[model samples]
Target: MYKLFVAGALAAGALAAQLTQVSNYNNSAKAKPGMQDITFRRPWWVYVPDAVKSDALVVAIHSCQSSAQKYFQNSKIPWKQGSDRKGYVSVWPSSTTECWDVSSRASLSHDGGGDSNAIANMIKYAVGQYKIDPKKVYVTGGSSGGMMSNVMAATYPELISAVSLYSGVPAGCFVSASGASAAWNNSCSGGQSTATAQKWGDVVRNMYPGYNGTRPKMQFWHGSVDSTLSPNNYQEEVKQWTNVFEVSQTPTESKKDTPEKNYRTDDYGPNVEAIWAVGVGHSVPSHLDASEAWFGL
Candidate 1:
């Protein structure tokens, strides 16, 4: 009995240490714009309302020509869901050149030491410093930041709970700056097969080993009229995450309630969802109550 108790105590100690002592911290990942060694945000702004403590941390990345502060205010996330004690908190972190590298040889892999890993390091910082709940952590972004959000869901699936990607592309979509420009100009108007989707899913599954953990649920949005980004990319996002969650390739629930507005939704269980906001352009939706509801914030 004594031996069993000691073993249990040791196991608990190990878990505590693992949670408290986070590793692979990249200071550059949290740096501000215009620095010697690649910058993201300096002291990334954190929002915990009323000076209250927090239970969950929401990491939001800004698009091009935006900053952490701007994303927080303009992202339109429902922060009032907090019942008490600042039910939810948000951490806004900017990215380098307003784009997250998902295609380059450096960021597409598990140990690439790319911007994806750098962002993961940033999450570790918030989790450790704020003692936030890991299960409730989330990520969301718009445009270039949206692409990085997809990279995070793929490379750091074990770390984040769910992600809402808007106007983003699948992992390994663009390889270079010129390619990104072309994809933007052409809108990446292509479809991917289930096999291809599975291959892309493997990219995320390989990020962590021996991981029998719940995959992060995914949500996506794209404007049908968004010439900046093809709406077809939304389908690819859904397919990639559907493969990750091992759910049905076909959306179990598909609908467009507001035909006049031209908005439509395709939901593949809670693991993945895709929405097309009829005539909207390349931008984040002004009202994101659905995401807050999905997260139960």
Candidate 2:
């Protein structure tokens, strides 16, 4: 009886160890910060599963007024749970101010000195340190972080494979905020920012001048009724990305109730995809499964 009891206790201990949670999520992944190039305001929270398989990196940026920890701990998406199951390394990058520096010209320009450059350098360090696959690096975010995701992909197209932006405006759409606080852009967020497809594409092309390389594919998500960032930005984002990929504005394929309930999707071949969460508000629903599938993880 004593022997049996001891063996059962040992097994329970082992199971508990295997079930240890990371970032307060129910998973066997581990979380750490200060890996490389991390500063006070520009903080980072990284999660690696117990047994990594993909060797791919996913940069998950947080929404405005949210921290990396909060985003990672989000119950809706469950970052650590997905990381543990998929075996992908995930990093959560926080903004220096109220939001990422997507409005500044420095952030908009490739290799320019700003939050974008710093984040790129962090990515380089992470890639080298983790032995990550250069071809599988992806970025995703919501709201302000979503906007920064566009900036990252635009500025470092060669470094990023794809982007999943939620409720984000198009790159350069809010450049009017340059030389001002990087926090808020009244015109852009208010749905007042407008430009022709060619003009919007020109903004992205100018970010990496003279580079004719392939631009990263874009996956966009937006709540149809998102007033905080204005649902109009979604159409503008589709226009920008479609032009960048040189695809027609007309979707090659369109589907309803895809990815999630009440969510419609429009695909422009392999270059651009947009998901519209109908009747939703400031934030959309869980995009975990769809985004992972989109990243091919």
Candidate 3:
């Protein structure tokens, strides 16, 4: 059975939202049963609050090997009946495979075109089905899903207003030779010869285009202790997009009661900002906290 959560604010006419699962496999013939053909499977969980008036939606993407269900569970946002209400909708789309389709060095190809198109379709579906405010639509994800969120911001800037990335590298992070001139050239080659790796890194960076001015707001969060993906990539992401947005770095200090120490750096621009969550591990912080402080929710 599916899970449902509605807050008292929704009942009080402050907000109205609900959670449901959407099956995208039937939408395309490319989706085959079993393993006969490499078909694309698109399944997502949606959260809508009663307070939502129109055109305000948030798309939450999941990390590698993570499902939309788990993302919803990990999220501190209230998803059950009668909880704190925010008049908005959240949609989480699952990747057909364990990860996103950022494996290609050319054109950002995935298992099928559906991976990219499915998101657009989902947006269209939500806008039509609900009275949504298109200007306020935002996207956020972690790890592989975070990479996908960057791809979304780069490719479909018009549809999204802002993006929040948790422990996510740039889109070309997985590409063969994508970080030559930067400090990560040696590591980009995976311990291969620095000279050879640098060549590949340069090629990767050149081939892929950085975010132009016509992009949405952006936010990045990474754990300083995270060894999975080097923290340098996070810095590169900030540098590459410096021209498009006005950046700001704010160091977070420890509170009297909290033992864990963290620093937050925010890059502000016309409609975008990137927040680097330092000293933490590879995980998205509490949405209630991030929403109130960083996201301005």
Candidate 4:
């Protein structure tokens, strides 16, 4: 009878472990179990599916004026529902400031003890806690979060597999700013962040010096009429990633009115792609589906 009881208890414990639900966690730079020291004490949330069929983990970052729970629960992308069906874990992280620190040198440098490093450490925590495959980790977001996605791609190339950015700028576009002003760059957002392909690629390579390895694939999206962040930033992002991939600036494949009306796609190569959503505003939730597909989630 005792043996049967023990067996039943073990079964119940396993079942509880597999339950699907959203969990909240608080972590600081002072206590890191499996990674580098995180300088910020940011809170994060995770959505675990009932059955995690794959090893993929998607880090969904919120834009400016947004929180982790707000993005996770209120996104138009049906994040929870999609995770349930797609069998991939979703992590949402809140920014310490109003926006991600993309323009700051600390955030731009590799492990330079900024919000970016804090985020990287958080991802490492998620990987170990959930037994996630490091090679399958991905990041996606809108506006400031989108820009931070590029920051992560540049600074922590080894941690991400692919990224889908919405209304973002190129890495190091706002490097001219410092302090709190780094949170928002008027010049970069005003469409003055232009550079040659080689120059932009050099900015990314400088983030992690002497590191030659496979960089993560990238997908960039922007609303053609987005005034909040000038549409020109999209073109700059294309220049940046194409140069990193050593591909031509001209796309090999161009599709018009694809996936939706007035939405165009350009494929520079397998490693780089861009989408221009016509007549849209700063942020478009409709492209979230395509972003997930890009991550193979």
- lDDT tens digits by residue: candidate 4, 81-132: 7678788888888876788778766677786667778778778888888899
Candidates in order, TM-scores: namely 0.73, 0.86, 0.67, 0.86
Candidates by TM-score, descending order:
4, 2, 1, 3
Instruction: Please give the RMSD of candidate 3 to the true structure.
Output: 8.4
Greater lDDT among 1 and 3 belongs to 1
> Which residue window of length 10 is worst by lDDT in model 2?
26-35
Which candidate number maximizes TM-score? 4
As a TM-score, model 3 comes out at 0.67
TM-score of candidate 2 against the unseen true structure: 0.86
Superposed Cα deviation of residue 184, candidate 1 (Å) = 7.7
Which 10 consecutive positions of candidate 4 have the poorest summed lDDT? 17-26
Instruction: Pick the winner on TM-score between candidates 3 and 4.
Output: 4
Which pairs clash in model 2?
A: none
lDDT of 1 by residue, 86-189 (tens): 45666666555545555554454444556666677777777877788888888888887787788777767778988877787775555454423112323343
lDDT of 1: 0.64
Question: Native-vs-model 4 lDDT?
Answer: 0.81
Distance (Å) between predicted and true CA of 142, model 2? 0.4
**Local error of candidate 4 at 228, Å?**
0.6
Local accuracy of candidate 2 as per-residue lDDT tens digits, 1-297:
999999999987665412222222222212122222222134566776777888899988888888777787778655577788888888777665877877666667775666776667667766877789988899988888889899888888998898887889999777844354374778889998888999889889998798887677899899988989999999999889889888899999999999867999999999799999999987786577888878888
